[model samples]
Target chain A: MRRLRSAISTASAEFQRHYAHNRRLAEELRERQERARHARPQRDLDRLERQGKMLPRQRVERLLDPGTPFLEFSSLAANMAYDGESPGASCITGIGIVSGREVVIHADDSSVKGGAWYPLTIKKIVRCLDIAIENRLPVVHLCDSAGGFLQLQSEVFPDRYMGGRIFRNQCILSKLGVKQLALVFGHCTAGGAYIPGLSDYNVIVQGTGAVFLGGPPLVKAATGEEVTVEELGGAAMHTSVSGTCDYPAGSEEEAIAIGREIVAQWDRPRKWDCQREEPEEPYYDPDELYGVLPDDIKKQFEMREIIARLVDGSRFHEYQPNYGTTLVCGFANLWGWKVGILANNGVLFNDSSLKGAHFMELCNQNNTPLVFLQNITGFMVGRAYERAGITKDGAKMIMAQTCSRVPKFTVMCNGSFGAGNYGMCGRAFDGRLLFTWPNHQIGVMGGDQAANTLAEVKLKQMQRNGEAVDQAVIERLRDETRAAYLEQLSAWYSTSEIWDDGIIDPVDTRNALGMAITASLNAPLGESGYGIFRF
Target chain B: MALALLLGAEAAGIEIVRRRPHLVVRIDGREHEVVERDEADGRTRIELDGRPLALACAADGNTRFLRLGGRNLRVSLVDPRDAAAAGEGGGDEIRAPMPGSVVTLHKAEGEAVLRGETILTIESMKLQTALVSPRDGVVELLLRGEGQTFDKDEVVVRLASPSAPGPSEPAPPEPATAEASPAADAKGAA
Candidate 1:
C-alpha cells in the first residue's frame, strides 16, 4: 500500500475563490436554519409562559435524556407553503433517547396557530411515524393541538399519506410491539383524540389536558345534556372514571416525568451487529471540501474528493475504478459504518449503468447499506450509446436498486435529472431517507434544455395548425417556462413540496448519514431479488 | 472468498490460499504470509512477508480503506471471477480517464520502467491519481508535462513494450515543467 499523496495546493488562488463562495453558501444555510427554529412571534412565547405551560421544545428537552443527540427532521418544513403562516410545519419531530430508549418524538408547536394540523403538519406526522415503524422505534407524542384545521381539511383528509395514515402507522407500531406514549397537554378534539386513545401509554395533565371525539360546543349541539368541559372529557374524568388514560399528572413537568418512566420500562429493541471499527476523522480537512467542490453544475469534480472528506480517515477502497469511468463505485466508512457508494462523475454511460447495478447487487449480497451521491445530467443519448444498450443498463440499475434489501440513502449533491433520478434512488424510490444540499437542482431536464424542448414543440404545433408562428410569442413562452422550471428545481422549493426529507448543510452530510444508518439497524435486512434484465 | 484489489486504477485478484495461526494470502498469483500484529482504535498492524506494516484500517458501511507504505488505498473485496475479467489493456498509448491537469511527470522519455511504477500524476477535483506502467517498458513519448491539461481519454503519454517497434515521434522538445500557471479556476483541476 502507498500513502495517497495530495496534489492540491490549499493556498492557491483557485482554491481560495471556491472556498469563499462555498463558505458563503454554508453561512446562508446556518441563517435559514436559525430563522426557522425561532420563527414564532415573541407574543406567542409570552402567552405560553403566562399560561404555565412549557414550550414544545422545552417539553422535549425535559422528556429526552440530557446530553443525548436529538436528530430533528424537517425543521423548516412548510417554509414555502401556507403563504408564510405555518413555520416548522407547526410541529416538531425527531429521534431522541428518552429514558435510554431511542424514540421518535412528534411534538406539536402549540405556539403557532394553536398547533393545528395544517396539511403539512399532517404530512410531517405521517412521515415521522413511517420512520418509527420502519426502524422499529417507539414514539412519544406531545399532544398539544387544536386538531385538524377545518379550512384545509380537504387537502389532508383524503390522501393516502395524510390524516388517516398517521393513525394507521400508530396501529402498525402497536402491532409490532413498538411502544408509544401520549402527553395530553391541550385539546384533543375529534380525530385527534385517537392519538392518546390508541397509544400504549397515555399521561394526561389535569386541567390542561382534555380528550373527546367532540368538544363542548359540538357535544352541546348534538345532545341537550349540557355537560361541563371537566365532566365531559377532562384528565380527572378520563383517568379516574374512564380508563382512557394510564397516568394523571398535575403539570406538564409531571406528565413528562410519567412519560419517561413508561418508556424506561420498555426493553430496548435489538439492532443488527454490523462490522464496525472505531470512527476516525477523515484525513483531509472537511473545510477543504468547499475549495474543491464545483459551483457550476456543468463543472466536473472528482467524486472521490468529496468521498475523501466524508469517509473515516479518507481511506476509500474503490471497487471498479477503470471499467466504468463515468460512475465512480467504491466502499468507504461513514462514521465507522461500512457503506457502498456510487457517485456520478458525468452522464451515465452503458458501462457506468452496468457498474452501478453490479455494485448495488454486491452491497445487497454483503448486507451493507448504500449511499448514492447523485450529480448526473442523465443517461447518455445518441445512436452510439443507444446501440450500447443504455436503456437496458439503466433499467438493470433501477431494478437492482428497487430490490435491494439493505437501507439506501441518497444525497442530491448536484443536478439530478431525467431517469438518472430513478436510477439513483429519487423520492419515488422510497429510500430510507433522502436529503439535498441547498445548491442542488432537480428536474426531468435542465432549465435551458427544457425551455429549448418546449420552444421547439410550440413552433411545430403552430406550423401544423396553419397559424403564423410569432417569434416573440415563442420567446416569451420559453422564458416563462424556464423561470418556472428553475424555481421548481431549487432545493428550497423541493423541500417545501416534500420531495426530500430536508435541505441540509453540505457539512452536516456525514453526521446525518451516520444517524440514518444507525437508526436503520433497528430492523433486520430483508431478502433481495430483482426483475429480469431487458437484454 | 476472494478480494478484488484496486491497486491504483487496476483491479487484481486476491485469495486466501492458507491460514493457520494467521493467514497466507495470494495477490495476482503471488503468495505472502499476512498476519495481524495488533488491532485497536480502528487501526490494524499487519505483517506481510514478515515485514511489519502499520496501517490505519477503517470500515464504514461496506467501504474499507488501508494506509500502507505511505499510500492511502481504497480496496474492495469482490468475487474472484470479476477480478479475472478486469485484465489490463495492451495499448502503447496511455490516455487520461477523466479531464484533469497534469501535476507531476515521474519519468522521462527512454527511461526503463518496471511494471507498476508511477508514470505521471493527474489531479482531478483536488485528488491526485498516479498512472502506473502496465508492464516492463521504455517510455517512448511523454507528451504531457507538469501543469499541462488534458481531457478525458486523451492520449497523454506512450510506452514501447520490450519487443515493440521504435518510437515514431522524434526527440521530444524540452518544456519547462511547473512553470505553466493554472489557466482558470474551472481549468485548474477537475
Candidate 2:
C-alpha cells in the first residue's frame, strides 16, 4: 500500500473556517461529556459519600486495568429525556480491560435518583449485553440501581425490549458460556436483584451493597414483616445465609478487588485468526480531520482524505477505483487489523452499489472485517436511474452487507438519509458497533426536503378541498416542520434515544474502531451466504 | 544513480559508496568518510573527512534544516523521479477530464496564474473537482462560463503561447523558438 496524497491546504481560508467551527463542536462535545460523566447534585454526591461508595466512573476506573482505555457506550444516553434529569441514563457501560481480559462493564450511576433505571437506561444496558453476546465478550456488572423509574413504568417495564430484555440477554449470555460477574455496590431491588442473581459469580459490599427482591419498605408493605435491609439481602445474608452471592467484601474497594480476581479466573476467549500486521501511525495528522470535514452538512468532501487520516500509515489499496467513482471500496489496516472500508463520496449510483456489494463479498470471503464510513444521502433517483435498475443494484448491496459473516462496524461520519442507510449498514443492520460524530445527522430525508414534501402535500390537500391556500400558513408550516426535523436529525437526539452506541470525537474514531474490532474477534465469523442478489 | 541534494542555489550529487565500519559517500566525484554521533546535550556531531562539526538538525518532509557554526542552513533532497515528472510540461489547452458544468471560475482570461492555482471548478456526478493551472502562464481564453456545460476532452481554457507577448505587457512578440528555449531553461532552474 502507498501513502495517500493529501491535497488539503491547511493555511487556506476554508481550512481555517472549518477548523474553528469543528474545534468549537469538539470542545462543546468534550464539555457535555465531562459534565455527563462527573457533574452531579451535591446531595447525590454527599449521599454516596455518606454511604462509603465511589462515584460510578471511579468504580469503573478502579475495576479496569490501570491504564487501559474504556470505550464508553453512551455518555449522553438520556441527555434529552427525563426533563434533563438523567445524565448518561443514570448508568455507565463500556468495553474495558479487566484483569487482562476484555470485558464489558455496566456500572449503575448511583449519583442520580439513587441510580434509577430509566427507559433509555434499560435500552443502553440491553444494547451493551447484546454487544457482549455478539462479540462473545464477558460482562462485569456494577450492580447498583433503585429498580425501574416507576413513573415511566409503562415505557420502561412492559415493552418487549424494555427492562425484561436486560435479564433475558443476561440469561442468554450465561447460557452461551460467556462469563458475567456482578459487584454489588448499592441497592439492587426487584428486577435489579436478578442481575446479581443470574451472574456466574457475584460479590457484595458489607454495609452499602445489598440485593433484594424488595427493599425493607416493600417487604413491610407486602408481608407486614418489617425487616432490616442487611437481614433481607445484605452481604452477610446473601453470601452466608441465602447463598445467593458468591463472595463478601468489607467495602466497595474490596469488592472491586475480589471482582478483579474472579475475572482473572475465567478462561480467555479463543479469538478467531484474522489478517493482522504491525500497527503503524497514520502519516497524516489525525488533527487535520477538523479542517477536512466541511462546516455545512450539504457540502461534499473527498472520503479518501478521511480514510488517509484514519488508516494505518495513511495507506490504502483502493478497490474498483475507476469503476465506481462515488463509493470508495478499499483495503486498509485499522490498528493492525485488516479491514475493508466502504465510504460514500456521493449518492449511490448503480455502479457504486454494485462495487460495494462485490467488495463486501470479497471481505467476507477473505475473513476481513467490514468498516462502513457512511456519509450517504441516498441512491440516485430519476427516470434514468430507475431504468438502469438502481433499485436492484441497491438491493444487491444491502443484501450483501446484511448477510456479511465478517464483523461489521459503522461510523456515521455525516449524513445518513433514506435507503442509503440500509445499504451502508445503518443501526438496524446489527453492526457490531456504531458510533456517530457530533456533526452527524440521520433521518429518512434531509430537513429541507422533508419540510418541502410535507408542505406540498398540504397544498394539494387544500386544492382538493377547494380551500384557500394561504401562503403565510404554508410558509409557517414549512418552517415548523423543518425545525422539528432538524432537532430529531441531530446526533444528540440519535444518541439520547440510543439510536447509535454513542457520539464519539472525530479524532478518537481510530481508537474506538480498534477496540471494537479487537473485541469482535473473540467470536468466530458467522455462517456466510446471501439469500439472493437482485441482479 | 546519485541522488540530487539542493542547498540554496547549488545542487550536489551524492551516492553511498559503501556501508561498513564507517560510512563512505561520494559527493560530486569526491569520496568522503562520514560518521555521526549524538552528544548528551541533544546536538549531533558529524565527522566529515575526519573534521568534527557539531550541528542541530530538524527535518520536515524531504527538507532538513541545520544550525551549525552560528548559522542556519536548509538542505532539500529532490527525488529524481519527481524531477523527471515535473519536467514534462502541460499542453497549452486545459481540457475537461469528464463531462461537467463549471460551478466557479477563479481565474479570467489574460490573467497571470501560478502553476497550481485553481482555474475553475466543475461539478459532475454530484462531486465538484477543481481544475488547476498546469504551469505558470497567462490565460488566453476561458471557453466555458459558470453554469455552462461541456463534454469530456473539450478545451476549457487556453494559455497564451510562451513566445507571444502577454496581454498586460502590450510588447512586441518575440521569435517563437528563440524565446521558448530560455523560458524552458528558466523553468528548469526554478
Candidate 3:
C-alpha cells in the first residue's frame, strides 16, 4: 500500500469559498444535533427533576464506559415529523461500550411528553432493535417511555413493523443467544411492560419504577377494583414475589450500577477475525474534507481526495486504477480493518459497473468487509451505452453487492439517484449500517431532472387531450414539482424517514465507520456466493 | 529486489544480504557489515564496518527523520511504481479528456507553473475537474478561456517545449509531435 497523494490546493480561492460554505453547513449540523440532544422545555426538565430521575442522556452516559465513543443512530429521526414535538423521536439509541462489552443502548427521553412513544418513535425503536438483531449486538433498554401515544395508535400499533415488532425482535434476539438487560425507571404500562419481561435480565428502581400490563387507572376501569400504583406492580412485589424483575434498586443510580454488574457477568462475544492492523490516523487532515466537497450538490469532486482523508495513513492500494476510470475500487484500512471500498468518481459506465462487480466478488472471497462511498448521479444513459449493456452491467454490480457475505457499510457522500442507489447499497440493500452526510441527497432523480421529466409527460398528455398547452401553467407546475422534490430529497428528510442511520458531519465519517465495523464483527459473515451475473 | 530510499536529491538502493551473527547488506552494489542495538535512552546504536554511531529515529508515514550528532536529516522511501510512472515523460500539454467548458482559469499564458498546479478547471456532466500542468514549465498557450468549450482530445493548454531556449520562451508550432505521441494526450485523461 502507498500513500495517496492529495492534489487539493487548500490555499486556492475556490478552496476558500468551498471551505466557508461547508463550514457553515457543519456549524448548522452541530446546532441541530445539540438541540435534538439537550434542548427541552423547562416544564419537562422540571418534572423529571422533581421525580428524582436522571435525564435520558445522563443515564446513557453513566451506563456507557467512560471515554468511549457512542455512535448514535437517527439523532434527528423525527426532526421533520410531529410538528417538531418529538426530538430524537423522544428516545436515544446508539452503539456504546457498556461494561467493556459492545451494546446497543435504547434510552427513552422522559423529558418529552413523559417519554411518550410517537408513531416515528416506535419506528425508531424498531429500527434500533433491528440493528441489534442484524449485528448480533447485546441490547440495554432504559425502560422509561409512556408506552404508545394513543393519539396516533393507528400508525404506532397496527402494522407489521409497528410497536409489536420491537418485542418480536427482542424474542428473535434472545433466540439467537444475544443478551439483553432492561432497567425500569418509569411506569411500563400495556405493551411497554413486555420490554422488561422479555429481557434476560432486568433491574427496577424501587419508588419510581413499576411494570404492569395495565396501569392503576386501566385496572380500575376494567375490573371495578381500586388499587394503588405500588400494589399493582412495584419493584418490591415484582422482584420478590412475582420474579418478573431480577434486581431491585432504591434509586436510579443504584439501578444503573446493578445493570452494569449484570452486563459484566455475561460472556463476551467472540469476534470473527478480519484482517486488522494497529490503527493510525489518516495522513491528510479530515477537516480538509469541508473544502474538498463542492458547494453545489451537482458539482463533482475527486473521490480520491475524500478517500485520502478517510483511510488509515491516507494509504490505498488502488485496484485497476486505469480500467474503469469512473468507479474507483480499491482496498484501504478503515480503523485498521482492511476493507474494500467502492467509490463513484463519475457516472457508472459499462466498464465501471463491471469493475465494481468484480471487486465485490474479490472482497467476499478474501473475507473482507465492503464500504460504499456513494456520490453517483446514475449510469450513463445513451443508445451507445444501452447497446453496450449498461443496465445488465449495473445489475451485475447490484447482484454481487446484495449477496455479499462480508459485512457492508455505506456512506452517502453526496448525490444518490436512480439505480445508482441500488448498485451502491441503498437503504433497502441490508447494509449493516448506512450513514449520510449533511449535504447528501437521495431521490429517483435530481430535483430539476424530476421536474423536467414530469413536465414533459404533462405536455404530451395535454397535446393528446387537445387541451390548451398553456406555457404559464406548465412552468408553474414545473416549479412546484421542483420545490416539493427538493424538500423531500434533503438529508434531513431521508433521516427523518429513517432511510439512513443518521445524517453525520463529513469529518466524523471515519469514527462512525470504525464503530460500525467493530460492532459488525460480533456476527460471523453471511453465507458466501452470488446469484447469476448478467454477463 | 532493492528498496529505494531518497535522501535530499539523491536515491540509494539497499538490499539485505544476511542477518545472522551480524547484519550484512548491499547498498548500490556495495556490501557492508552492520550491527544495530537499541539504547535505554531511546536512541539506536549502529556499527557500520566496525565504526559506531548513535542516532534517534522517528517515522511519519513513509518519511523518516533522524537526529544524529545534533543534525537532522530526512529520508523517504521511493515507491518504484511511482518512480516508473514519473519517468515516462509526458508533461508537454493539457488536453480535454471529455467535452466540457472551462469553469475557472487559475493560470494564464506566459506564467511559470509547477507540476500538478491547476491551469484551469472544466465542468462536464456536472463534474468539475481541474486540468493541471504535467510538469514544471511555463504556460505557452491557453486555448480555452473561462466558459469556452472544447472537444475531447483537444489541447486545452500547452506548456513551453522543454527543448526551448528558456522557460519564458513560447512553444513553437509542433503539429507532428502532438499527432505522433499518444502518451502526451493520455496524461490529462488520467
Candidate 4:
C-alpha cells in the first residue's frame, strides 16, 4: 500500500507541472498577439487622434487602465461621411477597464463644433450604445454640448418627411439596462439636456455650468419669460424642482468629488429602508420656532431660516427662486420619499413673492406635502401691485391652499394675520396641523398695531372725561394690554377651539414637525407613472 | 357578395387607393353609397346618411390622393407593404408610415439595419416621425429625398431582412399624447 501511494504522488506532480507549463505558454501567445496588434501601423487612428482633439483614448486612460485595457469598438468613426474626415463626430465611444472591470465611455469632444449634435453625431452616439449592449458595460457620458446644430442638421438629413422624429427616437435606448451617468461642465441646453435627463444621475457645477430645455432666445419666443442665462438654467433648476439632476456642487472639483462618491455608492438599485421613521423633533414647544425668527413678529424674517431649523439639517431643494420670491416651494426628505413644501417667506414682500404662491399651488396640485411659514407684512402695497399682476396671483395662491391633497402643517412663529396669514397656512386655514410658540398671536393685526389703535381710543375717551393722563404712559398701558390679549388668544380654549392643533416648546420644533409630518395623513400615495392632470 | 369594384377591394380587408380613392371604405363597420362623377372633370360625390359627405382629392394615374374632411386616403396600383415585405423576406417593411417629408437617412443602401435603427425622420404638421428600422436587415434601398412629402404607406426603402431573431420591436405602444382617445378623459386638456 505504501509503494502504491508513492507512485500516485509522483504521477500527480508530473500532471501539475504540465498544466502550469501550458498556461504559461498560452499567456505568452496572448502577449505576442497584443504586441503584433500594437506593431501594426495605425496611421488613420493616429491622424484622427492628433493633438488633443479626440479624448476617447485619454478619457479611457484616465478613467480606466492604460495597458491592461479592453478593446474599444469604434475608436475612429466618421459621421455622415461614407469615407473622409468627419472630425471625430463630436462623440467618441470605446471600451476600457476600470479596476480591471470593463466599462464603456462615450466622451464628447467640445472641440468638435462645440460638441453639437448635428445629424452626424447622432449615429456616432448610437455606436457606443450598441457596444454597451454587445458587452454589458456601464456607460459614462462626458457631455459638453451647446445644443442641436439646427443649421448643420438641416443640411445633413435631406429627407423632408422625417424631420423631428430623429429627436424623439431615443425613447427606448434610455430604458435599456445601462448604468448611465452624465457630467456637465459646459453649455448643456435644449436637446443637450435630454441625454443628461435620461441618464441615471448627473453631476453639475454652479458657476462654470448651465442646463435648460431651449435657451433664452427660444424661451422668449415661446413663453416670453425673460431672465439671465444662468438664472434660466442653473444648478438650482435641475437639483430642486424638475428632479432632472441628482447633484449640484459649487465648483468643478466639487462636482467631480460628488461623482466619485456617487459611483462608489451606486450599487444596483435597491429599496431604501426608511427605518428611522421618527420625526426629527417632538411637538412640545411651538415657541422654539421663535428662536429662529426675529423677536418681534412685526419684523419680518426669511422663512428659509425657519425651514432650515425645521428640516433635517439642510435636507431641502427650493425651486423657482426668482419666479416666486416670497413663498418658497421645494422638495425635501422627511424620512425617504421626497415631500414638496411651499412656505411663506415673511421678510420679502413683492409681486415676485405673491407669484410664488401660485407656483407653490402647482406643487400642491402634484400632491407634495407643504409647509407654510407664518409671518408676512401682508401683500405688497404700492405701484408694485397692478404691474406685477398680484391680484390674479393672490387668488391663485388661495385656490392652491384650498385644493391641496397632501398633509400640511404651519408654525405660528409670530405674525399670522391678514391675507398673508391665509396664504401661509394660518391656524384658521385648512392646514393639517397648526402649532404656535408661547408668544403666538393670531389676529387681524399684530399686537403693536392693536396697541396703537387702542391707545388713541383710550386717550380720546380720557380727554373727554377731562382727567389727567400722560400720552407716553397711556401708550405703554395700551401696548401692554394688547400683548396680553394676543397671548390669551393662543391660550386654553380660545385658539384651541379652532386655530391650533397643539402648542409645542421652542427647542422641540424640529422633532415636533417630524412627528406631525410623519404622523399626519401622508399624501401622494398613488401608483407612479404620470396620470392625466386637470391643469 | 355582388361587389362594386371599389367595395370588392375593401371587402378583402385591403386598400388599393388613397387620394381621391375609388375604393369603398367601412366606417364604424358600415359602408355608405358614394358616387364618382365629373362635371368639369370626373370627381366622386360622397353620400352618407342620406347626405353628401365631402370627398376631395388630387389625382394622377397609378396614384390618387384623397381627403374627406380630415380623413386621408391614397390609391396605389400595387400593395406597397407586400412588394417591400416580399423583397425583405417577410419582415416588417420600414416605410414612410405617414405623409411627411424625410429629414435624414442614417444608413446607406445595402447596409444592415438593426431593430430600432433610426432609418430616417419624417416631418409632418411640424411633428417628426423617426422612421426606425422595424427589424434587422441589410438595406435594399434608401429613398431619402429630404424635404419631399410622400403619401402614407408609400414604399420608402426595402431591406434584405436578417436571418437571426430580431430585437424586441415596439408596435403601437401609445398614440400621440395630444390625440384624444375615448378611454382617457379624466382631465381637461392643459
Rank list by TM-score: 3, 2, 1, 4
What TM-score do all the candidates reach, one by one?
Answer: 0.77, 0.82, 0.89, 0.31
Query: For candidate 1, lDDT tens digit of each residue in B111-148?
Result: 86554456787765323455665545679888888998
What's the CA error at residue A232 for candidate 4, in Å? 76
Model 1 alpha-carbon drift over 4 Å, by segment: A1-7, A459-473, B1-190
CAPRI quality band, candidate 3:
incorrect
**C-alpha RMSD over true interface residues, model 2:** 14.3
Calculate the i-RMS of every candidate, to one decimal place: 9.8, 14.3, 8.8, 32.6
DockQ of each: 0.06, 0.08, 0.20, 0.00
* Every model's TM-score on chain B: 0.41, 0.60, 0.58, 0.37
Over 4 Å off in model 4, which ranges?
A1-291, A347-353, A382-392, A458-484, A489-498, A521-535, B1-190
The ten-residue window of minimal lDDT in model 3 chain A covers A5-14
Give the per-residue lDDT of model 3 (tens digit) for B1-190.
4678988568877888988899899986888998888888877888888788877788976888987656788888997687887787556778775566999998887887666556787776555666666666788889988999887559989888877755464434322111111112222212
**A1-535: candidate 2 lDDT, tens digit per residue:** 7567675677778778888888888998899999888888999999888888888888999999999999999888998888889999999999999999999999988899988889899999999999999999999999888889998899889889999999999999989999999999888999999999999999999988889888899889898998998899989989888999999999888999999999999999999998998999999899988987878777666688789889999988888766666788889999999999999877788988999999999999999999999998888776767898999999999999999999999999988988999999999999999999998998988898889999999999999999998999899999999999999999999999999999999999999999999999999899979998976
lDDT of each: 0.79, 0.86, 0.87, 0.51
What is the per-residue lDDT of model 1 for residues A1-535, given as tens digits with 9 covering 90 to 100? 1112233556667568767877787788778777777767988889888878888989999999999888888876888888867877888898888998888999988999888999989989999998898888899999999988889989879878879999999999999888899999988888899999999999999888899999888988898668877888898899989999889999999999989989989988999987677888878777787876666655555566677777788767777766677787878777888899988866677888999999999999888899999887778766666787889999999999988999899999878988988999988887888888877898888888789889999999999999999999999999999899889888877877768777887778888888888888997887768779776
Model 2, docking class:
incorrect
Q: What is residue B102's positional error in candidate 2, in angstroms?
A: 6.8
Instruction: Please provide, for model 3 over A1-535, each residue's C-alpha lDDT reduced to its tens digit, 9 standing for 90 to 100.
Output: 7888776678777788888998898888889889999999999999999999999999999999999899999999999999889988999998999999999999999999999999889888998999999899999999998889999999999999999999999999999999999999999989999999999999999999999999988888999999888888999999999999999999999999999999999999999999998888999999999988888887767788889999999989888877676788899999999999999877788888999999999999999999999998888776667898989999999999999999999999989988989999999999999999988999888898889989999999999999999998889989999999999999988998889999899999999999999999999899988899987
